[model samples]
Target: MNRPVRTGTDPDEARARILEVAEQHFRRIGYHKTPVADIASELGMSPANVYRFFPSRDAINESICGRVLNEVAEIALAIACTNAPAVEKLDQLLTALHQHNKMTLVKEKHMHDLIAAATQENWSIIKAHTERTVTIFEAIIRAGIEAGEFEVEDAAEAARAVRSAFMQFFHPVLIEHCVQHSEDIEADLRDQIRFILKALRKRGSLEHHRQDQDSQPIHG
Candidate 1:
């Protein structure tokens, strides 16, 4: 006997389609406004079927916002790979981080919904992002210490201090700050970077400060 071909779709592919539709809906209508039915309708699938893939509208929302977070991670990864001078890298990182956090994640609809989304589910994707950022800061701190550029006692502690400059990179805190002062987001981000850098330079030498003008790695 000959066997017939299967016509049914894969569960994973169907799930991805549902999430894709939900993401667009969320961006256009905000999380509260976009219901499960709306996502099902947009995906041309039954609401129950969509539910089968994602347990609820909230789950779908997490996947949606998580996708955006992944995009931000992609940008950070690309920047982290560049071997530019630490000062130039620092400048590039701050500018990119501020604009991405402010423009892509915060300003987009889901706003607070996105923060809630992050809390509701696994955040392995964003975890990878923070790790990457920390690695970059650690490398710079060690480089500075070796080059006699910075006089820090511990590179690991200094790296953590530098990482603190990016509180906005974490979703929940970012949303809360944005909600309180959406108007002054840029100022807040810049001030945060400035404060962290100042703290990082704790007892560091002045001869080789981290400056784009110098174009030199701060080596001990």
Candidate 2:
């Protein structure tokens, strides 16, 4: 039932074809069930040739995972570079991240096991992705501070805090758990963002500050 492998492309295209077929098998059956031979067979090539491009099955997985995470990074970077205020940008970034995780882990689940393995194995790709995310957060926080929109003295620390605070909404494992448990994720996410904005905003700028002052009784 399998088609014969055709050879005419250069090395670059050949490697790319291997990755494409491997991803197809990964999505169809799963990472573990799909072997290098299956991917090679799908491409009408030998498993040895697949290794010519990738050293091992795990290497192929890491490459694919990196590609997926890189997509999110690119999206976040574009949002961070926008003219929107830091508050609005942060909200969009977090919302986008949650949506991405929901689509990947909850809806499609094509790469869930690979992500889990990356987590347990402490893959370099995962570490790089986390660092890149933190760096993007830092950039947005720095912009807010420079624009006098946030009161934080240390942008890097604030960025780290934001990432840690929103881990529940952004982290893949937590996202999966919350989805499976039917948690009110959106409500909680909104509340958390509100809290983050309140903490970041320069005091006295919020309308409620003046309202509270007007409501207070005169003191002797």
What C-alpha lDDT, on a 0 to 100 scale, does residue 155 get in candidate 1? 80
Give the range where candidate 1 is weakest over 10 consecutive residues by summed lDDT.
Answer: 1-10
TM-score of each: 0.68, 0.87
Q: With candidate 1 superimposed using the best TM-score fit, by how many Å does residue 46's alpha carbon deviate from the native?
A: 1.3
**Which candidate leads in lDDT?**
2
List CA RMSD, all candidates.
7.0, 7.1
Local distance difference test, candidate 2: 0.78
- The lDDT, on a scale of 0 to 1, for candidate 1 is 0.61
